[model samples]
Target: MTQNEPAATTGDQETVALTRPPTALSGDLSPRSSGTVFESAEPPAAASGGEPPEDPPSAPKAAKPPRKRRGLLIGALAVVVVVALGATAVFTIEPVGRVFGIGPSAVPTEPAPDPIDPDFALIPVDHVSAGPTEAGLASALQPSVTAAEVGTLHAVIVDPGTGQSLWGNEADVPATPASTTKILTSAAALLTFPADHTFTTTVVAGPTPGSVILVGGGDPSLTAVPEGTDTLYASNPARISDLAAQVRENAGDIAITEVLVDASRYTGQAIADGWDASDAPSSYGGFIEPLMLDGGRSDPLNDLSQRVGDPALEAGNALAAELGATSVSAVDEAGSPADGEVLGEISSLPLVDLIEAMMLLSDNVAAEMLAREVAIERGAEPSFAGGAASIIEVLGENGFDISQLELSDASGLSNQNLITPNLLGDVLSLAAHPADESDTAVSQQLRPMLTGLAVAGASGKLTDRYPAGASAGRGWVRAKTGSLTAVNGLAGVVTDRDGKLMAFALLSSGTNATVARPALDEVTSALRECGCR
Candidate 1:
């Protein structure tokens, strides 16, 4: 890589002769040079098979060999740049000053496109299977559960490749599902509704003039992103400001004075029966109301922030503020106007987006609303109990067994909720395998759950769970996480070392979540490393 030895031609490079030799400028190196002294010369010596002439015919005083310094100064010789790759050397040169006293012009070229940054780094798209033995897989995973200080733990690992059980330890028993219940909730929602279905919110004329109702259709993705800004959710939901503008437009010659909210699409207790008192209004859980902003998050943008006590009333109040109401208007329940005079309408993000958000963030509020949506679709009451029942009904109809389950709430926030590792595995396996099985329609729809599950050490709830000890599974394991003070679960699909997809469920109880979560994570991590054939 060193300079070409100043034309000595060292290393692997050969010095290419300059197409034209350097010549002294008839004039000085400044302003004008077209009218200086001139000299006529013969072809350069290199082309004539001889050395440079003793002196140009018109040199200032050259009849004999010129002085060494004078020759070097007069003809510095064009610099020829050489580049070598392996045994091949390429030479290039930029001719400056003059070649035969003529200046060379550079060719014009198109500029390169500006490089744009990619959203995320590319990861391995293809998985290679090591094809390990199944009996060996069971032997390898059995101890992660049996050797731990964890109590009341159950685990099941099944290869999605052959629909065969690879490992299990008390896996058929029902245990607290924690937030993992959202997985079932998500599957049922996708099963009962179209992937593009959106929760609808409508604004209609109220019972009296100068009044309007913001009818909540359970669109939890709604946000107040000003009149023309984007929301993090793909929905681009109905904004209260937009509704207010429409209300103003319809009211024409008069200023509307009041705004009301109707949140009756879902009817039931705001809180599930078996939920702990502290669960709601906490950072992780919220009132299970039909209408809420940003999943009832007090901060609207922070998923882990505390929730409001009455999400519906808060939403109504937000609408009232947006409408510039002088006084707080009492919210009332009412259907859309009988005359079909609608002021505004907004649809939540497509149902698939809600499922992804629920699974990625383990969003309890979104999960509950989706469950109720499932209930509504199934001709059942849109309540917690009804939603849970509807999920069971939908899953049972889709070739999954729910006989050993008790789902008190759709969110799995209730300690009373129970689910078997076997069901979890079966549900997950449904997503990994083909759609030609029974309930083909349902299975096809449920396949999106695979994408919704957070990638290990990469996204959503599972982002921070896979530490260095589990580095082997990073970007390889995909799973949903469940955690309460004493309950922890991890269940999802993973491509085993053998490249065969595996569905696993690890539910543990009677241990601190801090300890149980990592232990369960280790179990899934084991699946990623297992090459069971």
Candidate 2:
């Protein structure tokens, strides 16, 4: 729900795979640097020796003022030199040396830390503590979670290492999850599809001569941008113009007259149940058509631009213009000719990239498309009901309890969605589980969701959050945010002050987002700063 604001207040609202760690996914582990850095201080001078008694007559300069005294001074001087050299070593080892507050490297040139590695599998492995006890965590969280702004809170904190809830407050109660519903959709997609899978849009010969049929492949990211232009969704998206070029070349000098659009891949309502019709033409979302350009945006380059009501037909018109056709129309109920010759085809970006983008930007359109893809793959109807049922089915099969879960759409734009904080915590626990501690097949497949989460106050919809009282969680918390009229939710993982990783979920109802959001953030910030053993 944190996407670009829609004009009509309808637009933006926005895995389950189990497998062992695959060799192809391995990478160098880069853990978060632990331990404190302190500046080295000079040892206090030895009592000053009374400042040499104001030069005291040059101390009766006898030939080296006693051999025993001279020997002692030489020994002391040797000790000082050795200590200084060791201190210098501590300061000169670059990043490693900076960890110890000694030596010449004590004063770092840069104050800010380096960015965290984007790979989720490479999370920090060393934990200094066993994690907070339930009592301790409750003590630290009670005040924040119960604040006036956080109405009817349902929350839980879990230690991913053991898959146990350490602290909770009515966490089993169901609440509107808003955009956090993407967690279920994204998980189901990853579980059902290969990471490198792609969707293809194709053009083929129409039934009539000099006519072409454009077949939709359910790829909403397809763009109408010119060859040299940049795209908002994919780095290099499949272009509509390219398809037209292929059509021109294949057809030779034949005069192209009509373009028939085929959107038979998806069935049922173009819009999901409970979604506001005004939302589609605004910036938040659009109809879930099989064929659409720039996610149905009126302006391809502007993410917040209004969307078209008939994206499938709109796509057909674009192709018609490119082919210099005189008329464009949608295929009849019977659909495009089954044996039409393939004229031109383009593939979308890989599933892995699309999922990441969907999570990061809270792309309502992308979420819906991917959800339907999951439904289709699972042999369910490709409608809103089917997509919702498919997500619950896949997650339920993979060992998650769905007794209390309910969904109306993949994107949380629908207010009908209900999810328990405990369930979300369970999903995040699997995602944040350490590889060495848990070898379950499901955990590995869910690992990528960790990287997709927005870093609090640093990335995605959370970029503007975690200010002031909650600033401690800024870069430390990675979460999926959800917000609607009276619903606010956050679910993610964070490393506590003692280096222990914990997954948490907090859902608030009957409160304004502006107030509930900050209160929820404060509670998580408390978790980040807690050493509540």
Candidate 3:
């Protein structure tokens, strides 16, 4: 049997057809068409009755057109071409964009070439040396200076730009900085707050119409008493008086029978943790409360009887009296004014100006208040801890190495506070020449500091020390004086013989400050006579 034939079955016969229909190359094929016919060309097959002729093997359909192969090759070549084009475009565009196009303008043109003179290039603090050479100021003061003597002397002389010790007996040691601490507080204040910023004291109505509360915002310079009046010592604070007048004006037909002062903003803890309990509770170490009016005093003139209690309550009482109210009481809670009207509000000096005053007078109270303000402004815990932390942050930001420095309070009241002369000098330099010129807060606020310094025996604590004369520091030295029992400190700017401004700090501990003042004055005289040759 042929391969195409099926095996015979007993009861049925079946035929299998294996021929496939011919496919036209383009369109349908016709019998009369000119195309070749496979049937006429084939040899005759055996008759159906005879043994089936051996079926010839059919050839595979014309091998499929090479279209698929061509398509795959074209796709591969297209991908290659695309890749080449992209690479060429990138290579051609990059250098052109860099050289001709605006691309950051060649590393910023070297920062406008700093205009510092080479000869007067102030020595940087880090590179200062302490050897015994003509250029080394520390060496001149070392041989005659003893560690014990170092702690006794107050004045120190050094280059503001360089941390080098020019001539100081106890330059390396730490001493009570007194109001000099205001410098740090001012620095931190300026850095944390705006220059034009003012402290607001609001007189808000209490829960009842007849009751008004005085809210203290720690404004150290607030005053209700007139300047140069005997009643100034007995009268109420200025802002409080204004608020009372406003209430009276608003309550034209009505009468305020009761006034309550609210002093609840600050913590009850008045004295700092490290403060000496034995020390007198003078106005300088005034109570620390949130609602203090006129800096926690009933009168600015007399510190002895200036009633120290809840400040807000005092203010409220004063306002009540001024408003013709019959009753006044200190309230722990806040309340609205009797007339439901806002009384006149008073603001303390700007932070910069306040700082300046604090610096010049070396006022401990101002320094403490400023420190608290700085703490509050920085969103830190509003206490001595917060103040110290704020100071460290400010110093670090201004490029000070505060690793060896320790501070407990802004006034340097605590003996625990310690700082080296080098660090102090560095801070002075920064204060004198702040990195950010736009920031005038510190410079403006530090005016009081300069005014507070002993003007060559002109006034304040230094009135008798550095007398104005050819032999004394007349106009050559202007500095802040610090004294705390055994601790003595003097830090400020002085103009040398060559008219160069220099900042210095001399701190002494473990000696009588009164006795050390003369020696410190001598040191200042030496610096004025002998320029840093």
Candidate 4:
């Protein structure tokens, strides 16, 4: 499932105090048009008939809704679009959310984002009994392995409750993981980067007087979202207008003659190797640049919107518009500032939020950006080769076997990438229950990964799944989905009938998603229903 095609085209609570470069591509990416485009749940400027809201409310509000992010909100919307008996019914999720006053949208003014805290209260495994006997579990799952199971399926189920490998079938064999590779990218990111990490976009005095440079700090959340208006993608963005205001203050009357975009932080080709040329500017696939607005979306609000070919330039234009500069002249590698004085800077959301967005939307560009951020953190070159090498290095440092895996790109957009189901399940196990329970440090750090996996028939990639036979897993199974022409996979955690937490990874090849998706869903469904005591 090269995410470049279906991925954007696609969290948890752990309260670890997090703060750093802050950021949004948004909570969840809505999949629409051509199968590759996506949009976060940002507020549209206008309403019905492009009209404004009936009236502005001048009242304060009360009530705290569930902690909402783009993934959660979009996942909830997916539930409504699907599974609802009344398909033609017209309704709005906002009013329903407002009645309860759960999210930021409910507030008249957006409240400052709360610090990173995953409040990890996953059904405690202390007293939970082991899952069904291996034999019984095998019997339960055997029905799901139709003739389709021949030799293409590689799967693993881990019962974290008992800390045992519950099942495996060719699980250790590495194969093309498709988008399931994001699990590795995200895990490595969380393990190494701070809980609250952020990418920064800065405005520094350029090499010459009267020249202003907008340096790309690998911040994609920087957006064209109008002032005071918020979108999921721009929950907390580095605004060009803010930069403009700061520059105006610093340079008394000296007019800014030019706005230069500094994209020197990243090196290598804009598009990654093994990627389709069309994927670079596709709604789902965007060039890997340090600076992009709304994830390289031209419309800034629609995921299906055309992607700008030169995001660095588009970003420069956005800043130029803010500076009141009629047009941007050119883009060049920015030289060191003459003085150390910084004109202005804006930070992205912490690393936690970015990781959540990546998992929720399966954002290929976001995944690449995060991996590059990791590369920067590790002092590796910030490119696909560097990111791929760094992720492998980080995973090896953390004790995962590096010998079994081969990675081409961070977002799992490459058909050449190979990973085993065993590693996938192992990663999920680490996210659910770490090496040290007494310290619980790993659990605290990796908990967000669990929170971000798609819920069965409920959210994210699983939204349209589980409509009927797999209903047992609805809201019960939480995992990631991977699909390519002849590949399909699912990986994530789920609480079973015994209330036991389990991690599972199923990677299948030689079959289309239509045939393999339901078969894999049935496997998770079997887990949810199996109460073998």
Candidate 5:
């Protein structure tokens, strides 16, 4: 039969295709030798009764054809194709094993990651450490003064590098900071406003020929002193005299018959809501108005004056009178002058310098004026309320926490204002230096302002306070002095033995300022000498 034909075997009653067999199959046909006999003829009838079966002799089993090598070769080719297909699927598919029936363990999986602790992730541990200990620098400041006096004293020294409480009683308590409050105000102002900002005072032509209206820009430093009256502007007063003369000169003998003063740039609101009504108006406690120039006029006769009676309008009028002007009025009702001509104009010292003066001398009128001016610039009402809101807004933008702070006015003239030492300390530290390495304007401005402060046993209100060698500190303490009826405070930078600068604030409340001043000075002196260890 052909290779494609099926064959029937007697021993096994199954059809089999015998085209090719394994190479091991033998070619010899010795069927009789084993147990069965294979013949070329049909088998004999069983008992003579069966007729002889006739069938063509099955074709001699073709030599179990030489074992086909092609079968093995086809199987090997099929295996190679399957392996290649599996590899292609694995390379092309994202998650390969799921698409085909292959070794599952061969697939790779990303291992689970460790979870993070939220609390530990948020804390900033760069500069701070654990709580203060008795054996540390804080313990060195332990009070030697008795408890009876301790309750009346708010004294403490601190290492600015570490927030360690060095020494004192009632250090944690809040107290009226007095002029010390200016530190906070100055820092906030400097941080919030640009250093080169200049305040404008315009001179517009009035209705009358040769007459000009001096528009107030809340410039407290406007001066008219001829050449040399004094080195400082505070001592030597200069008004708008030269400016008006120049205006007259430009106008060619155009007599300034009527000079109208415009003081409407700022809102009329002066004193803050929380200020006490009974405080002396001359004591720097009077509410600050935007229009009243020169710390609300130091003269007593000027009813328009808010603090000392000397009104900036009066000063302007005096300058005009000296320059041969007919009249001067401090009325805010003047309309915009006619466009006759533009006259001379003067600008106030840069905002940075003004702020430094305010901070160093603790000038209440200047501080209040600046606060209101800031409000006006921001397009808000130039009232104390508006100023407080603006200050808080600026502080918040700089990442400060204003929850515990209360600001009724820019100057600490009002007993209603309250701030914590910690908060003040934090602000001072950040603003102590300028942000740009090349610009030392802030530092230079701060130097002049600081010189205005009352030095111990030298100048200002502290002319004769601390004696030499109070506790190991002498001639080394330079700080701002604060005093109120029930509050006294001293806060500033002190250099230790190793030349390390340390910033500290000591505030005392519910005590006599006169009695507490010495204690505060003593603590400051002690810190200066590194007596607190």
Candidate 6:
């Protein structure tokens, strides 16, 4: 089908990897919020009023052991094994050889002619048994949640195996979700659009000769980088060079003088309401335009590079430069005629890859664009308000409760976004849920969302996190990180010591991100270390 045609519905797609190689966005974003408009209520005090008296306190139990990094523990075990082998060779083996007179009598040994082949495999989880008991999970997590640094919190942990709640604190209360909002945005995109779907950007003949129009198909991954070079959008992105080549080949002997950009596929303000004004041209986010090079970044290779003021116009200029025009200028914003001849066109990487990039980089522009795609597919107006409404509607159709949800933008850059912790946890649970008869079609489509999350201490925004007290979760935890001055959040999945997969969401407010984020990490680390039964 053509790029403008209504796309097919969401269906089973190949599972995507949650982690990816390091990129420019890392270390550039500060873990500070611009402001906190929502003040989350503190955890409630213990049972009050008519509650009965409890029994006397019992004796204190032994202190829990300190957490250990996975890599360090494995190294320590390897050292012990090597020392044991050395001792056996020197003492036990030598003594046995001497007593049996085997040292002199034993036949000489030689290495095998063929080399040993390595074996690699994925061991499936033993899901017949349930994960940690609810009481045990509460015991293991309560202390960490109550720490002062965590501030007012809403959190939940679930065993995805049975979709059971293992622990919770004000989980139903709605609060600012920060970037964890991407979870819902991702889930909706997977449910509404086919996995291999793509957006196209095309160059067509303008109304007059020596003029051409650049029409956007709502693809922000269109890039200005030289062909064959990598940009912040890792998947081989659509290149302006290739688009120009096509236009030049088709428009023979025509000296292109004017270039126009048509970002008509998307409607509404380039910036969302409630978004911080300073963020538009900053590293973390940019104006949400449909046609832009490298997601509107001034430096396509640098994730932290400042964004351009008018991304659509700038894209038109790039095409002008490529066409050898004297100057890049958008002669008309009205758009090309319906009968304009197609000069050239290019398509973005598959939608699945775009979702992966959005999650891995916590990319705001990509998220907004994807959300608009969702809106378009569902027949909602392709705008900030329409995208937000369409996402909530899609999730609701897939069995999630949307009563408490509120959104101003799909990227969660807006401080106005509000989502319950339970809702976030549920979305994650479905994403991580096992494939079986009981699994919903929504679960199958959302599985790719897991692969896009940042791995703790390994990739993306979580590359340097889970330190010290949270070391045990370094490789075991995979989550999406969120931060806005006093707001912080972590939502994703982790496998515990017992090999049981669990999904969790933690949103905090009334505290600085610097302290709350580390505290949140400690909580997930506790989950990784617990074999709570």
Best by lDDT: 6
**For residue 447, what is the lDDT in candidate 6?**
68
Candidate 6 to truth, TM:
0.77
Tens-digit lDDT track for model 5 on 246-271? 67676675666776677666665545
lDDT rank, highest first?
A: 6, 2, 4, 1, 3, 5
Over 4 Å off in model 6, which ranges? 1-121, 331-333, 468-470
Segments in model 5 whose C-alpha atoms lie over 4 Å from true places: 1-136, 144-174, 231-239, 278-280, 283-287, 291-294, 297-312, 331-341, 433-455, 459-461, 469-474, 531-533
Better of 1 and 4 by lDDT: 4
- Model 3 Cα shift for residue 349 (angstroms): 1.7
Highest TM-score: give the candidate number: 6
lDDT, candidate 3, 317-379, per-residue tens: 667667777777766544333464465577665554455445543455556767777777767
Tens digits of lDDT, candidate 1, 55-109 = 2234423322211100001111111111221111212212211111113321212
Q: Each model's TM-score, in the order given?
A: 0.73, 0.76, 0.64, 0.76, 0.64, 0.77
Per-residue alpha-carbon lDDT of model 2 for 1-533, expressed as tens digits? Answer: 00000011112210000011121232221111011111111222111110011112334444222110000000000000001100110011122222212134322223322221221111113433477888889888878987999998888898887889999888998888888888888888888887567899999998889999999997877887788665655446788998898999988887789999998887877667766654555456778878999888787765445578889999998998888898888888788788888989988876755776677657788888898899999899988889899999999999998999999999887878899988899988886666563457687677656655766644455644554222467556678887666677889887676667788998888876657777888888899778786
- As a TM-score, model 2 comes out at 0.76
Q: List the residue pairs that clash in candidate 1.
A: 129-498, 129-499, 130-498, 132-531, 132-533
Q: Give the TM-score comparing model 4 with the true structure, all chains together.
A: 0.76
Report every candidate's CA lDDT: 0.59, 0.66, 0.47, 0.61, 0.46, 0.66
Candidate 1 lDDT score relative to the true structure: 0.59
Model 2, CA-based lDDT: 0.66
- List the lowest-lDDT window of 10 residues for candidate 3: 70-79
Better lDDT candidate (2, 5): 2
